[model samples]
Target chain A: MNDVIITAIQQTLIEGNVETAETAARAALEAGVDAQTILNEGLMRGADIVGQQFEAGEVFLPQLMFTARALKAAMAIITPELKRLSAESGISSSKGRVVLATIQSDIHDIGKNIVSTMLTTGGFEVIDLGVDVPIKRIISTALDEGADIIGCSAMLTTSMPFMSDLIKTLEAMGQRERFKVMIGGASVTPAYAERIGADGTAANAVQALQLARQFMQNALA
Target chain B: MDYLEIIDRSDSGEYISEENWDLEKVAMTCMRLVSQYDLKWDRQNLVPDDPALADRVFAAGLALAVEIGAYNRSSERILRFERDELESALRDMKQTLSMGQGADERVLFARQIEDSRPPLVWAGNPGAPHPEALFLPAVVSWAQEPIVDLITCGTLAEVDGREVRTGEALEITATRRELTYLHQALAHVGRPGMGMLAAQSSVSELGDLAAANPDYLRTCDAHLVPMLNELKIDNRNIARAVNSIEYGMRNGGLYCAISGGLGGDAPGCALISVASMILGLLTNRADYHILHPIHIRHVATSTREVLWVESVVLQAFARNAPAIIVTDVYPKSGALTRELLYETAANALAITVSGGHLEGCGSADGLVPHATGLEPRLMGEVGHAACRQGVTRAQANQWILQLMEKYEHVFRMPEGNPGARFDQAYDLETLQPLPEWTRMYEEVKTELKEMGLDLSG
Candidate 1:
């Protein structure tokens, strides 16, 4: 019965039926299915399929966005139960916490949003600070959230200096080693990333997810 | 509709969150229309020779414009438009635009598929960043090209060695200095009266407002009022139009629809491009429009998918609306390489044969200051040669496929083909191409000639 409910949740989420996904999550919880099992088997599995489809070019941004919405809906219903279980069992399920933002004065967010969705699907808890975010707010939010990675995006060359500034500011605050900094955007290059002292850069969202995973593994090491 | 009506409607229209507008109104609506029109993107034909497909794309685009309308980011409302209003705007849009004054004056008119007339070359390294020292020489490089009808410029990465931040007071200084350099460069080339699509330093309306003078950006020049991704606009762009209306500068509405973004693939992007153009006529009060469809991954128009999007969008506008459209040619490969020329030739052929004026050789995807006049020279050369030979869609597609084989591999590489910076490609003292760069250009020209693109004209 639990397997049937989990499959139904995955199907609804993959189909991007948000309300139905939320209903499935509630039903799973009512049927005494562990919140962690629903998240691992249903929500995460659905998101993984959507992400795989997006990477394969079989689906596009709208479908990815719709599935993300459905996942968000389902997560909202399951998060409280998961938190209760974590407190009782003393085991967290998240891969890692990440803070994402488009650097100051750059209003372009499509790329950043794509990375955010991909990261969320990868099981990282993402705190997405929307477009035109200042350096101070980003650092403060990362510190506050205990984030493992701080991802910045800049679509304009004018705003790209802020990414460098972010690194310099972190170094000045003696917090440079605290969080991993990864930058990507139309204007960002790997050379610029190295020049700015960023941990790494990615060409697209899939590479960004891989880079984030690599960063987390390094942190563990 | 006037700018006042646009503002009023922005504030008074039905409220919708930006996310909802993007997903539901823009994405969902485009998918429905794509299905309704049965618009399938033919990957093999980068430039389709089907008039029926063009008409269907136009109808779907018009329906999209009427259904989705423009979303106002500042007001968080939908700037609704009746079909009649959009149609009337399209009907009233200027079919011909007069730019510049005196000897360098040029009139840009609506072009048709297989247009016999040589498409005008608006050359420059548009929106690319340039150091202050290289800015003047970069503009002069293109201005000295005899085939270039008008010139555009990149943004100054620094002013007096200080970084220029957008929306800050320094932006005004940067914009004015950029124009001053542009004016100096044009006079240096004795094309002082040449029109320009400039003010790229203006990341916001402040710089645009500061540059509105006879000394800098003149009434004869044009500045961009860009639409955000998909079908969205903010007050900064509206303020640009409002400033240009009374100032009498030409407003170029820039719609850069992403290939794999909200509007799915090539066909969906083409439909969004058409709808964005129609809405831009009403909201941006644009005299002319720029079709710059960039790939979501590559961010370059020279990509196969982007070239297809540009081709179809240009054809749709040329066959149906007949508006003055300029297509941007941004190649992933930069200067001092044969790949840049091949990419330029491919883009020039596709755009020229599909009824659009050419505007760039924004090298290295316009990400870095890796552009020079040599590629734009090749762009003009290929464009004129294509017209002179009366290249067809089929022939152009074949040539484009050949050219893509030369440079499309760069898109897959981890570090893209950022060939060389301007300083490396040109002799700084004379602002002329070095032997190595010129040799590459000559070689590419010979190869393209062998492929039947006669550059003898």
Candidate 2:
């Protein structure tokens, strides 16, 4: 029965059929599978494969976006039950919480949105601060939310200096070690990120999710 | 009828949710219209050589304008235009834009497909980062070139020993300084009245507002009011357009549409590019349009796929609207290299033969400050040669294929080391390209002549 449910979820997400994915989630609940099990074995399993194909170039942006939409639909149907199960068992659903924003003076957010989508699907809770975000707002939110990581994006080369400024601000507050800093964008490179004192840098959304997971593991270690 | 009317309409239009405008309505509607029109691309000929196909793309682009309109990100609404309004704008749009005053003035007019006229050349460091000291030198480097008709400039990485933050007071000061340096550069070149494409230092509307004065950016100069990528706009751009129009300045639209993002692929991008051109007309009331379709991966338009889109879109506007279109040449490689020259030749050749004016070949994807005046001169040289030879679409396709074979392998490679800065590429004392850079340019021009371009005039 678990195998059937997993296959149903996988096929629905692969096809990007949102209604069918939602229906599959409901059916799995009716068939006596626990919500955590369903989330881990069914929804997450399907999303993980899609993310893999995307990174491998077997799937393109349009296909990955569609699959993400379908997975969101399935997660919507299963979220409440997962919350109930977590409340009863005293456990968490996500790996760690992250706060992401596009740095100030530039309003391009395609990369940020992609990273948020991939991170959320990879079992991390994400607080998206949208585009052209100021330095104080980003730092304060990360502290207030107890964020495990703060990722910033700047597509223009002019806005790239802001990432350096953000890292400096965190240091000035003496809260630098509390959260991992990740920077990525079209104009940003790994060398630039390291020079700016970023803990991690991702070239694309798939790599970003992997970097987030590594940050979480390091925190636990 | 004017920019104020458009601004008021953008603010007062029916409010829709951002979700519907960005995700659900825009892309889905564009996809549906693309399929319905049965538009397809020919990879061999980057610009569609067929007149009928060009007309079809134009019609489809107009249909898209009437359907999707332009989404206003600030207002959360779509600014719709009547068919009559669009038609009138097309019918009465300026054919020739007189840039600059008196002895330094140049006229930018429309070109038809295979038109034998020399396309206008506008050159400068287009938003590339420069050290405070190098900014003026870079402007002089581009303006001192005899072939360059207009000037744009790079921005200073720091002003007054501090970073120039956007939407801050420093932005206004930096922009004013940019124009001042430009005025000085023109005076140095003995063309004191040369027109400039203004506000290259402005990252927001505040910078533009500060520089809109007569001394900094004159009414005769062109102001670049850009549309956000993939059919979106904000209040900053709207304000720039409204202010420019009200001040009797000629506002032009500068749009860089992502190929793989909303446009889907090469063909979809071509359609979207056409739609973006029309959107510029309706929203900004632009005097001229600059179409830039960039690859999401390489962040340039030098690839054969992108060249084809540039060709077809130019033909669409040329054959249908009489709209003056200026195409951008964004190479993946940095300047002062053989690969950069080849990419520049291919991009310039395609634009010249397709009846589109060339804006620049500089700054290497706008990621580095590696551009000098030499590449833009080479661009003008090659462009003039193509126009004189009356190059056709078939001949251009063959030449470009040969050109791409030289550099497309490393098109996606990362720039491990930084590109050469302005000081390294040019001599600031003489405002001339370095000896090595000039040799490389001459060598590439000779190589082009050997490749049957015969640029030896």
TM-score per model over all chains? 0.96, 0.94
RMSD to the true structure for each prediction, in A, is 2.0, 2.4
Per-residue lDDT of candidate 1, residues A107-175 (tens digit) = 898999999989987888999998889999999999999999999998888888889999999999999
Superposed model 1: Cα runs more than 4 Å off:
A1-7, A30-32, A139-148, A167-178, A218-221
**Candidate 1 lDDT over residue span B69-120, tens digit each:** 9998888989989999999999999989989999999999999999999899
Taking the candidates in order, what DockQ does each have? 0.74, 0.44
lDDT of 2 by residue, A51-125 (tens): 787665455455556667788888889889888888988887878899999998888877787788788778888
Segments in model 2 whose C-alpha atoms lie over 4 Å from true places: A1-4, A32-42, A48-62, A84-91, A161-165, A172-174, B416-418
C-alpha RMSD of candidate 2 = 2.4
Model 1, native contacts kept:
0.78
Q: Indicate the residue-level lDDT of B256 in model 1.
A: 94
| Model 1 DockQ class | medium
